[model samples]
Target: MKEFALIAELTRSLPKNDTVVVGSGDDCAVLDLGLPDQFVLFKTDAVVEGMHFLTECEPEKIGRKALARCLSDIAAMGGAASSALVTIALPKKFDVEFVKRIYTGLNEIAAAHGLAIVGGETTTNPERVLISISLLGLVDKKKCILRSGAKVNDAIFVSGELGGSLAGRHLEFEPRLAEARWLAQNFQIHSMIDLSDGLASDLRHILHASKVGADILASAIPISRAAKLQARAESSSKPPLLSALTDGEDFELLFTVNTKDAVPLLDGWKKEFPKTKLSCIGKIIAGHSLKLHDKGGVRELSAKGYEHFA
Candidate 1:
């Protein structure tokens, strides 16, 4: 019942597709279109009750998040979401009104993002409620970003702020679709990922895939006000910046750009995206481990994101 074992058992191999360059086990799955002009991107994700949400949370929010989880994957790939499939397994005791509200929320968000609800299946589960979604998207082949393309000396960048999801931040998060599109159109982004897991765990996905290491400045992380407030109220100590480093479900984009192109690309992005905040917090290096630098000096980091059945 460990996390990896459960994933392997319930979600083994992906459908065989000649176009798939990389599938099923990365930040975003990639598909190659024969044409040099475009490629297809696909990703699937799930939300389970008692894990992703409180049992008492509004049903509408639950549905919105179910779809949001998948959309966030597309956003991470620098792709435009085209369609989605939704599947739900509800217990027999589920309420009719709750199901209706859930559909309402799902449809509303899907429409706003220009995604069509193409198909899905529903079944009864006696244990816990489960919502799973598969999303399809498109990106220019030349512009498609992968998790395996980072290089030494590249500047590491993260979109928007991080941390604080335990304080209701995860429920209201907006996927970085527009920002990702802007990045694709404007720069040669080397690698990218969405921060669904904590930064430490998720960053490992990018580094291990790219065969590169990174050193992040501890002070540069943007901790949300809500995270700080919660930490102080609960612990009677200074807020744990580690929460920003390891908290899951932030839904922000984490990406890298070559050092030579970083300045100009950032300048252009600033003029075009005044509201979305971007921060340069680290650099890709030639080793195999991630290091965090603070006034106290460098230290190894650990993956502290949410782990199921751990």
Candidate 2:
């Protein structure tokens, strides 16, 4: 089975409690935890050598990517990161300096985000290095965003450009933490998710949770220069538009808002994040299918984004 299929099966019978405000199927698991005004956001992510990074990659970048992945999930929930516990599994005979360099990168990013590296476990993995991060965050009860809040006619927006993450953005991209917080604080965001799994796949998460569909405009997609260049440089590479649709690890924010707020959000985003490019790529519809629109007109989008065990 594919990764999501297995996840659906496993999550079907998971244990839960009253404190579980949102569990499974979200960017982070939200818990009430008896907090009067805030909800606790919990997220865990892992990066494996060879799968997520190469052996030749810098240890610092590998460590940074490990933590940044979890931070992106926290940002997806529109929360502020608080602390983290890291677990690193390595071969029994590991280089001491390399391990320390990994922590150096992790610590630097953690400090920049005001997140403390509290504690964790170090284990042995016989073959490759694996770094797992469990992050904790807090969000205002009313301001928390979820994939399930999208509604019909809501306009979908994506932050920054998309595609060609393999070129290096995957290791160094900044989490859209501040951008997500600003959107939640300033606008009535209907729904939000970070684009880690590419727009094609991640948008489906919102649609599935919200019980809506989307009509994406191909021409409106903001393709990254890397994506365009890759297409031009390599005949075997996916076209720029397709890469923008399916290249995972963009780590940008994908969100929706009422159509009435679209103009205002764009205007506000420009003033708030002049360096970031926010594009209104689509709109939610009544059904449960994803469709793409271009000069050729509308058609069901059959292409899927990256998936494990596919």
Best by TM-score: 2
RMSD in Å for all candidates: 3.7, 2.8
**Residues 1-310 of candidate 2: C-alpha lDDT, one tens digit per residue:** 2898999999999999899999999999999998899999999999999999986889899999999999999999999999999999999999999999999999999998999999999999999999999999999999999999999999999999999899999999999999999999999999999988788888989999999999999899999999999999998867788899888899999999999999999999999999999999999999898988877667677547322211
lDDT of 1 by residue, 1-310 (tens): 1775686676676477688787776656788867577788878888888999876888888888898878888888888899989999999898888888888889988988999999999999998889999888888887888888899999998877777786787777888888889888888899999998878878888998899899998888877777787688876643457778777899999999999988997788789888878888899999988988887777777685222211
**Pairs that clash in candidate 2:** none
Each prediction's TM-score versus the true structure: 0.91, 0.97
Best by lDDT: 2
**How many clashes does the backbone of model 1 have?**
0
> Can you tell me which runs of candidate 2 are displaced by over 4 Å?
303-310
